[model samples]
Target: MLLNLPCTIAPRWRRLALMTLLLSGLGTSHVHAFVLDWSQVTWNTGSPSQTFSDVQGSGIDISISTTLAGGFYNTPTQDNNQNLNLFPDWYSNNGASSYIDVTIRFTRTVTNVSFSFEDMDRGNISGSRPTRYYWEDVIERANGWNGSSLVTPTATDVGSNILIDTTSRPGDVLYRGNTNLNWSPDGSFTLNWEQPVDTVSFRYSSGSRAQSNPAAQVIGISNISFHSAVPEAGTLWLGAFLLAALALRSIPRVPELLRIRTRSVSENS
Candidate 1:
């Protein structure tokens, strides 16, 4: 008849053995880690003299300034240096729109990407629903590259479908209503989006409503970046298993060496 081992002892030994196997596997498999590198870029637009630099690809920065119209008492001014104006219906009156476009390049493949826009401020210009912000992700078509026809994925604000609406007010932040829109005291806004696209192009429109005086415009971007996720748990486990197998193969000789040492010790005694 065989004697039974203690229940506590068996479980403890099994756990230790299992942990060793797991760690060995982790050491064998090669895993890649990704980090965002956003250290070269700059943007500035309009008055209040705003500027931004060293932006990441996954993030964005924005700036805005107001101006007074000429000869008219309290008439809105336009920032002519960057061709941007802050008054209502400015784009329509000037026959032009104020905007900025940034192109970002990627070397490796990225599956899922998250984007954030910062410093979207319209100031304290209270009026009937002034649409001052627009954001979208532009991707190149898989087919041939056309200078004019670049494929654009549909962008949704909050949960509502997004359209070129100039009637959106400062308080109205979401493209739909389900997304979070944070407003800062300095007249800035932040918006985030999650989309899987190969190439990303950011377009900003400021004074697109004016037709005649289309000089005043203001806009900026910063903190643009992207990162790849680490490998899943299965990958790590497989690595551990391979390492454990190697470890076991070397274990057979350990007992023999121990036995030889025991004999040598006895002989010396």
Candidate 2:
């Protein structure tokens, strides 16, 4: 339903009502994609540091923490959120595995968000059938390629990493790469989604031995990209209604219009 305009409004003001209805479209708020930008941020680095604060970028904020003894976060080396060091590692072998949790919060709900999981070849606890997993989402791109390392789908060590069983948990990811401590310079894949999303995360765990950890434990993430969210249907409707109402109120009633015309005619006579 819309704002009900009085039918008795003078005919001269009908155009005003029409314009008000059209102006309501402005409330839709068609916004463009917002890529996370970190060129202005200044962050520190440590392998599971004692403490690190959250960082903010264009249209987004990021928080990184750990439940175990090792984790890492670095400011991007390049602009537009490139080369961000969000990898995982462990310093102590207290019978616990390595874990890292990264949560990216958007200023508002966005659609089709995504990022990259890079340099996941091997880790400190590399061994046969090691328990390793990483969780991510919101974009579509093939694995085995990051920029410098992977070229073809059949490239060496392309499918070396085996995906573990995650049927029970859809958000879980299992990976078992080759024995090489550092397989490729940039062995990685991407997860993309096309629907509406507000917040996304990256959670990782590994049973690789803490004593022999390598560069493989350093998993970098590319900048996330997504379009802005649209307003809800109710909000759009209400805005349109109010605009129409205000416009109609300024219109003179039929009697007032008639009196003005009559006065003009008498003066001419």
Candidate 3:
């Protein structure tokens, strides 16, 4: 009795088919998460020292002096000595200036972001009670990219007692969000951003309500999380093109493969 078998692909052909499948699966839906830290910061002059840098996986940098009048001090400390934190770094600002601005510049463009915040005073070390922290307004703003870096956005006080206002500044103001009231670190609050941003700035203490003494108020942040959206199909398209090119290059070898098969069949006969 004679038997017939269906045609089969060679090992190389099987590999090529697998590559095509993988290339098809590389869709544009991708996102990356980066936990903020002092190590990633490209520090400029007049920036604070690395005490905050001792906190691994989380940190924040504050400008000692800006075009505005206020200054900030940052140190690494856990909230109430608890595990819940946005980052280990905490800070306090004091000056005649109504608000203090903290800016975060990303190495990559980010479309979506979410971060947790606490407004308790570290001065109360018992961690059982909220300290004497007062605030009139808390605001956030984003600036567009000018090439690879963010353009310096202008920030003006909205009112007589207002702090830095990015809305009145030089660069394109892409997004804004704010909360009204005195913010303290007794608990945690998180902010999520829908607009894409290259740099993010947080305005603390608006409404002309600076600390009573401008020397007493303390503000603490636990951790910051950043999300980045992958660029549209450009990468996917490039991969698909490369795969198609490889498949075309293999076509010329197909005839050579058939000749070897034919020669094997003749020997069997």
Candidate 4:
């Protein structure tokens, strides 16, 4: 008797299970929010200013500020700092004795960020590994909007400042040596946060007190990549609710089917 009852509802039960499986799957994955192509991105700059338009496909409201001594410049032929084109553009410290501060601001919040560095002045010397240099950096985050500035950063405008080593390993600096000049082969740092961020700043400086190489003062900023996370919880729940309603709609038909089965059994008897 139990076997016969299950056979009567088997098709409906299978349909309900399939629907639930698909709807619940929505809760398990993430979607990409944005990707910035530096070459295609818009740009505007003045003596102490630089703007990256439409970053992360959000209409390009991001901005960067350099010290009076630091500013933006493009390589002779290449544009779009997205990757290592033969000729690339860059933002530099412009001979600042101290670290050059580059502050980045976004009109919308960003969740994950990856910054790429290209060598504008590493000597012509080619090697199996990236040479070590004297470089240091600090990355900080903020909640609201802030203008670019060369002045000292404040806690009100910037969140906690996290210092990061320039080298891939300890006791060393200027450390990436891959020859590809492409994004992955170059030097880069990435940050992932559970919370959204509106502002990010980087302070950079490299060189020894005795050395006067122009490359030491000039750091190449090759590209910028950032993205926001998509919201999926609502979709998951909505799908589940609709699927549940569909299963309920199937329940009423079960009684009609049972009545037909019982009538046939009586007729046979």
lDDT of 1 by residue, 137-239 (tens): 1111111112333333333232122223424443222221111132222322223223333345544433322223333333323233344433456867776
Task: Report, for every candidate in turn, its global Cα lDDT versus the true structure.
Answer: 0.34, 0.45, 0.42, 0.45
Write the residue-wise lDDT of candidate 3 on 1-269 in tens digits: 01111123345567788888877767556665655443344334333222223122323222222222343334233344332222111122322254455555555456555554454222222223234333333444433342455433343222222233446445433222223223433233445554566556555443232233333343444345556555447878887787988787646366766766776677678
Could you tell me the lDDT of residue 233 within candidate 3? 75
Ten residues in sequence with the least summed lDDT for candidate 1: 137-146
Poorest 10 consecutive residues of model 3 by lDDT?
Answer: 83-92
Q: Candidate 2 on 1-269: residue-level lDDT in tens?
A: 01122443434366676766676665766656655544444345433322222223233444433333354434223324355664444443222334555555444455566665555544423354255322211111122222233221211233334333335245444443334334244455556645555445545544332333333245555665666645566777787787768766776778776766676567668
179-269, model 4: which lDDT tens digit per residue? Answer: 2232332334333333456676654443221123323223345565566555577887888788879888767476687786786677668
Poorest lDDT segment (10 consecutive residues) of candidate 2: 136-145
lDDT score of residue 202 within candidate 3: 57
Best by TM-score: 2
Question: What global local distance difference test value does model 3 have?
Answer: 0.42
Q: In terms of TM-score, which candidate is stronger, 3 or 4?
A: 4
Ranked by TM-score, the better of candidates 1 and 4 is 4
RMSD of 2: 10.6
For each candidate in turn, the TM-score is 0.34, 0.52, 0.43, 0.44
* Residue 99, model 2: Cα distance from true site in angstroms: 1.6
Q: Against the true structure, what is every candidate's RMSD?
A: 13.2, 10.6, 11.8, 11.1
Shift in Å, residue 154, candidate 1? 12
